[model samples]
Target chain A: MPQLALNRLRERGSTERAALDALLDDVLAGTLSTVVDGKPWVVPMLFARQGDRILLHGSTGAGALRHVAAGAPAALAVIAVDALVVGHTTFDSSANYRSAVVHGTLTPLPDRERAEALDALSERILPGRNAEVRPMTRQEQAKTLVMAMPIVDGEFLVKTRSGTASPPDEHTDAWHGVVELRTVALDPAPAPTSTAEEVPRSVLDFAGARVLA
Target chain B: MPQLALNRLRERGSTERAALDALLDDVLAGTLSTVVDGKPWVVPMLFARQGDRILLHGSTGAGALRHVAAGAPAALAVIAVDALVVGHTTFDSSANYRSAVVHGTLTPLPDRERAEALDALSERILPGRNAEVRPMTRQEQAKTLVMAMPIVDGEFLVKTRSGTASPPDEHTDAWHGVVELRTVALDPAPAPTSTAEEVPRSVLDFAGARVLA
Candidate 1:
């Protein structure tokens, strides 16, 4: 597929490879959309950014994954809202967000790379988790399917909106500002079957890094 | 298109109308996927849930919006992750999330209803702002395109995962639990051009409601 040119709000769109990589790394999950039998099918999945490609994994039996493995064109979108831009008119009110959409074909990772891809995914979810946790068994690896889509330049588009809303035409003592929004990690709740009494370093680190700014 | 059956992890799938409604209302933005000329295109958009339909608005000149208005089959997905499940193994870890996918065709709202739909979109981004802000201008309404997709019962699916991960076999004193994640609203930053010194009630109420929970 060719690069998607931003037809509207061109100021907010970019084709920078760095920006695309940063967005894929910042957002741990994305909505993967694919064409199956000429119909659009979209599903949210957890993904990890691996170099120039984003890795997506699911059960081998998943119908959507199967369609992608069969060379269906796919598009993955990651969006993160930074703030709410409040203006003096309903038309000016909007959100400040970073959105990236990647268009490509998915290729199933070979069996030899599945374990490493899984680790990258695990690390994305929880940094330093692979070393702390037990390795995946062969049976488990066999049941999972890992796929990668190349993040070629010009194959993705990144659009971002920031700053305050456009100044109102006739200001009249109306409040206008930006309300920053962030995803924060709260305290952990131990599972009933957990034997460990204290939170692990990986969990603590992940939580600590996500404190409200 | 027929309803998508959950081929894998059937236990996590749901067809309840209430669940689908709740997920759509909770997530302010979603990724809209549409097939264009036998290829997939996905874009992140801010939407409002109006009764049994989702209202999506954008510039009238947007290419994607035009495609949808031209009778493209589209799927909008809203996903909110509640927590990160930590387990003793990488394969066992996952995220607790509520995901809803609405599959339908987008219909452009009539010109008479455009202003109302824009208000709904604004209210979703900033509650109670309609009363405080001025009404949208005629030109603003003319330049904007508002489309609605019916959230029919059988055409949508909601899947959710909650609580902690499944217990690990042969435990080795690993920390296991869920780290709750929430989208929080921080202190508002007034625009430099604003004449008002005090924050508006609408912003305060919205921020207060989004504190860590």
Candidate 2:
């Protein structure tokens, strides 16, 4: 679609589905953009990728989601910043990042599939905790809204920038390099008087994997 | 403005300006949302707060910035994810995060103020590096676009969720706590065969300061 076209820095944009899915799976949240009541609105949402579609969760009463379910066009963007590229000149400086942008109309999941979507979301976020946590109640399921936006129709763009700064200038010779940026999981801080439970293998993996890098 | 009202989870929204500016200063990037050709578009942008306004930078040729400059109503959202709350039940699990959403029309900076704005942005993101780097050429200045969005008009909302997860059901006792998430600076990776320069004090401060927490 014309909307998915990357106008500037075209070299950074990618059409690969693998890169798009990998980026969607890597970041915890994305900014969902939609037109609501004749104005643009954006909100941060916790999301997960299941099969070929992205699952977004929110309260059924959210105005943005309500507008989205009513067929307002939407865009979801997930970005994972890897490092800061410091260049000799200010114009050449930038950041190394992986970004996935998807445009489509959201299809609200049926009531019967909300429970499964929730479990899948839990599994994607906290890998092994789906089985450990108590089952979601019928009332709880009724209160939530799950949205699925399929990855198709060339509506997605994945762009990444990595490596050291290299500006094509002869006079500038300050320091040029990249300082890595990463999202690291720290030790879990338990609530007061709560039992010290064993940390799950998934938490360990998430902490050690350097997934954003 | 009714457009800025937080329809769902209205309790999390804030009207205080100090809290709003503090959040605007802490985060480095935000998703700038605007309507282009009657469709919603969201793009990640590096931004800085200058007094009561937010400064956003991009190439002059960028389509999204072009749209914003053309008077499309915009929403800029900055979110810092502090931790992952792992709870006894999946339903109770969530994240501790601080978010600020600003709705406004962008005002393009004049040629007279572009230099000052560019310096302000560099100082905000890289801290001390502005002094170390060479001055931008007039050609470079012409190629860049700086737009400022004022934080006035009651079109702003700051929402925050912090603390450990507390599942409503008492019977289920899985693990419960928060795993902190942070953006840390690793050792600077200098360009190949480049002279090693000391990391700037601003960068050091950025690396040391837990801005999200």
Candidate 3:
């Protein structure tokens, strides 16, 4: 088991999983971790969660993904946060974070749920993204594999390690410190051409919302 | 070797690593991926790099980073932008993304380098973050284990997958698409009531200069 230290919600169970879903809903992609040869590997992928499952779709011909499709159990972990707690000591050091660890088998979506799942994956990150971009034809969908994982099997933690860093017993000579933190969305970037004036709804809706770090 | 799409620069060599450094100069803590049980595990960390090595410090007494001291190889990947790739097919789908992956064996840092590295790590992210936070005492530094990995041995890549997504192979049904991007920065929360207000010079400099997502 991995050693994790969190202050807000110490347990890792169903609540954590729900927190993972909410974070996933707020962002488009996360750093997916998998181990090969006892060495860790990570890839960024766009994903969609349907009920208890996570839908992951990549290239129909990505060689890296071939490793996952070939009987590999990956740990799909995503960590998003509202803040980072820089405590004085290691014990007190923590983050106000939301994360999920999904340990399970992944098989590429064959001819089945590929199309709909891909659409879900696209739209989940950017609402109305699917309609604005090119739609996949049946032939393309058949070749694309949409991998899904059951959410119940995954263990997630939604808690925060916030507050001052408590110094260890031996360190009395130093000053305590902290980073006053927050992440606020800035105004949208204007298009290169002045006439391209309208902003997408995705921007309008998420422009000022709080997001994971 | 863990499988990953090779087309993007984030997975390939050192140029991307330096670029990643320049990017991180803007943000402090980032999500990190570590390998455990032949599966990838992610933990958020505050890190800094010098020469060919990346510095990762863990509490000697607590948390998941204990795994690093116990001999786990982690791939530290950082992503700065998440843009909608206006592509037609899943294969052509891309994003205007800037990600850097550094893979190396985490080794215990020599006792001599601990304090300097810690200072570097703090300053790299927030410029004067180290000054605001309490300074590390000798005993505390002694107890903490700093992991160092050569940034050179690792492959780095930065993929610019931005542009319109047209359905693969067929140009006839292509619908025009655009890359819609957004990035956020904080509103600069002030210090708590007790602590004196600290406006770091670099931060003030950052404020005056325009930063585009």
How closely does chain A match the true chain A in each prediction, as TM-score? 0.93, 0.89, 0.71
lDDT of each: 0.79, 0.75, 0.54
How close to the true structure is residue A133 of candidate 1, measured as C-alpha lDDT?
A: 73
Per-residue lDDT of model 3, residues B1-213, tens digit only:
001122323333346555766655544444567766556667655566776777777666645677766667777766655444434334455455556667766787788977887666655544554654466668657766677877763365444344344334554343324444433334433323223355445445434443322
TM-score of each: 0.94, 0.92, 0.75
Weakest ten-residue segment in model 2 chain A by summed lDDT: A1-10
- What is the lDDT, from 0 to 100, of the residue A130 in candidate 2? 71
Pairs that collide, model 2:
none
Model 1 misplaced stretches (Cα beyond 4 Å): A1-7, A211-213, B1-7, B211-213
Per-residue lDDT of candidate 2, residues B1-213 (tens digit): 011112355677778898888888877667888888778888776778999898887778887778788788999887777777777677777777778789999988999999988888887778788887678778878887888998895899888777776644575445677787877778777787356466666567666765341
Worst 10 residues of 3 chain B by lDDT: B1-10
Q: Write the per-residue lDDT of candidate 2 for residues A147-201, one digit (tens) a residue.
A: 8988895998888887787744575447777777777778777776456467666
DockQ-wise, the better of 1 and 2 is 1
Candidate 2 — which residues are off by over 4 angstroms?
Answer: A1-7, A200-205, A211-213, B1-7, B196-213
Model 1 has a DockQ score of 0.52
From the highest TM-score down, the ranking of the candidates is 1, 2, 3
Cα lDDT, model 2, residue B33: 87
Candidate 2, residue A25: CA error in Å?
0.9
The reply for model 3, stretches above 4 Å from the true place, is: A1-15, A84-96, A131-134, A162-213, B1-17, B24-31, B62-64, B87-93, B131-134, B163-183, B190-213
Candidate 3 lDDT over A142-196, as tens digits, reads 5565677666632544444444444445533322334444434545553332223
Ranking by DockQ: 1, 2, 3
